[model samples]
Target: MNLAILDGGTHYHREAIYGDRYRSRFDRAIYAPDLVLADLEDVGLLIVPDRIDPVLLRRHRALLDDFLRRGRTLVVLGGNEAETWVPGVDWAFRPLNYWWWLDKDAVPVQQLVTPEHELFRHLPFADTIWHFHGILLPPTGAKALITVPGDPGNGDLGGALIYEDCVTTPGRLIISTLDPFYHHGSHFMPAATRFLDGFLNWARHIS
Candidate 1:
C-alpha cells in the first residue's frame, strides 16, 4: 500500500514512539503543519496519529475530505479532543481506570463489537485490550469495533476504543482511542506493537 503517516512533530512522546517506526514503515511521513493535499497523491492509506496540530489539520480538512471522496482510507488514532477536525467523531472523557487490572476479579476487556470485522481478521481482540485515553460516541452510521463493557441500558460512556465511519464519506474512516503507535514506540506495551504489525499488514493487503 502507498501509505502516508501525518507526523505530529513533537519531540517527546510522539517522537520516541512513532519516529523510528514511521520512518521505516510508511511510504511517506509528512509533518502535519507541512502537509498539503499534494502529499496525499497516490496514497492508498493516510494515518493521522495522536497529538497532531489541530490548526494544521483544520486547515487541511477540506483536502482530507476530498481525499476520502476518492475512496481512499483514513485511519485516525488518539483524538479525544479533535472532533472538530474529524468529520463525525465526538469525544468524552472517562475516569481513568489505571488499576482495573489489579483487582483479583477484574476482567479488563475491550469487547469486540464487530467480531466479524476485517480488522479483527488481522488482529486478535486480546492485542487490543489495554488502557485507553477516553471514550467517544462515533458519528452516526458508524460501525463500532470495540467498546467498554457496561450495562446495556445505562447511560455510561464505556466508550468505543475503536470505531469507523464509512457512511460519512466516500472512503473508509477508522478512528481509535488505542494509541498503539505511542505505546509501541515507547517500548511500553508489547501488545501495541503486535496490534500495529497486524494493522500494517492489513493496510498493505488492501487492493
Candidate 2:
C-alpha cells in the first residue's frame, strides 16, 4: 500500500516524527494547503496527524470524501476537531490528567474493547494508555477498539479512545484521541514512541 501523511507545517514535532524517523516508509508528505484530490489519488493509507488546522480539512472536505469513496484508508490521530471534518464523529474535550500515573494505585484509564483486533498484534494495550485529550462517542456500526470508562468526578464522561469505521464510508477510518507523535517527537514520552513503532508498522501491513 502507498502510505502518505498530511503535514500541516505548523509544528516541528510532525517533521521530527514523520520526516526524520519514518521518512523512508512513507510515499509522500503533502502539505495541508496543497491537499487536492490528485495528491491522494495513489495513496492507499493517509495519516492525518495531530495539531493540523481544522480549517484546511474543512476546505477539502469534498476531496476527502471522494478519496474515501475510492476505497482508501484514513488514519486520524489526536486533536478535538474531528467532528468538524470527519463524518459521523462526535468528539468531546475532557480535562487532561497528566499526573494520573503518579498515584500509587492508579490503573490505566483506557480499556481494550477489542482485544482480538489485529492492531493489538503490533501494539499492546498497555502502550495505548497515555492520557487522552478528548473522547469519541462512536457512531453506529463503528467498532471501538479502546475505551475509557466514565468517571464523573474527573468530568470524564468516558467514550471511545480509538475506533474503526467501515460502515460510514466505502473506505476504512481509524481514529484515535491519542497524540503519540507529538509526545514522541518531543522526546518526553517513551510510550508514545512505542505506540508509533507499533502503529506505523501496523498501518503499513494492514489488510
Candidate 3:
C-alpha cells in the first residue's frame, strides 16, 4: 500500500501488537525532532498519530502541503490544541467520558453522519463508538463521517468526530480526534483493534 506512519515515540507497543494481530502494510518513521522530508518518498498515505511534535510539523508545513499537491493522502489521528497542522481544521477539546459504556442502558451519542460513504465499507459503526479525543470543525465542502448527536434545545450539540477534507488541499485528508493506534497498540480497546484492521484494508483499497 506504500503507507507511512510518523511515530512520535509513543507507538512503541504497536510493533508487538501488530506482530500478534495482523501484518501491517505500513512503514514507520520517527518524527525526528527535526522533520525530514525524504522519509516521505513513495508513500501514498502518511499517518500522523497522537503526541506528534507540532513544532516539527509546523517547521515542515510547506513540505506537507507540497506532498498533498501531488494528490497523496494524509490520515491524522489526534487533536491539536495549540496550532493547526492538518490545515482548515478548528479543534475543540471535550471532556471524554471513558466509562460511559459501563453505565446501565448506555447509548452512544456519536452517530454516522455519512453512512453511505465508501470509508465505512470496511469500518462498521460499532467499531467507532468507543471514545474520541475531541471534535473538529472542518472546512467547507468537507464530508463529516461521524458526529455527536445534536440536541434541539441546546442547538447543534453535535460536532464532527471524524471528517474528510478533500477541498482544503490538493490531496485527500481523513482527520479524526480518535486515538485508534494508541488504543490498538495497548490492547486496551477491542474496538480500536477492529478499527485499525478495517481502516488499513480500506486505505489499501482506496490508495
User: How far does residue 188 in candidate 3 sit from its true spot (Å)?
Assistant: 0.9
Q: Go through the candidates in order and give each one's C-alpha lDDT.
A: 0.77, 0.83, 0.74
Q: What TM-scores do the predictions have? A: 0.86, 0.92, 0.87
Residues 1-207 of candidate 3 have per-residue lDDT tens digits of 477766565553345224556445555554545457777777788777655667767776787787788899988777434236557878866778888999889988888879899979988988887877878877789989998765659665557888888997889988888877777676688888888888877877776
In TM-score terms, candidate 2 sits at 0.92
TM-score of 3: 0.87
Each prediction's total of clashing residue pairs, residues at least 3 apart in sequence or on different chains, is: 1, 0, 0
- The alpha-carbon deviation from the true structure for residue 206 of candidate 3, after best TM-score superposition, in angstroms, is 1.9
Poorly placed runs, candidate 2 (over 4 Å)? 17-19, 151-157
Q: After superposition, how far is residue 83 of candidate 1 from its true place, in Å?
A: 0.8
Which has the greatest TM-score? Answer: 2
Candidate 1 lDDT, 1-207, residue by residue in tens? 488887776653355435565455677777777878789888999888766667778888898888889999998887425687777778877667765766889887678879999888888888887778887787778899998765558776466888988898889998887777776766777787888878877766672
lDDT of 2: 0.83
Q: For candidate 2, lDDT tens digit of each residue in 59-169?
A: 888888788888999899887388888888898777899889889999887889899999999998888987888899898999999997887897766789999999999
The predictions' CA RMSDs to the true structure, in order, are 2.5, 2.3, 2.4
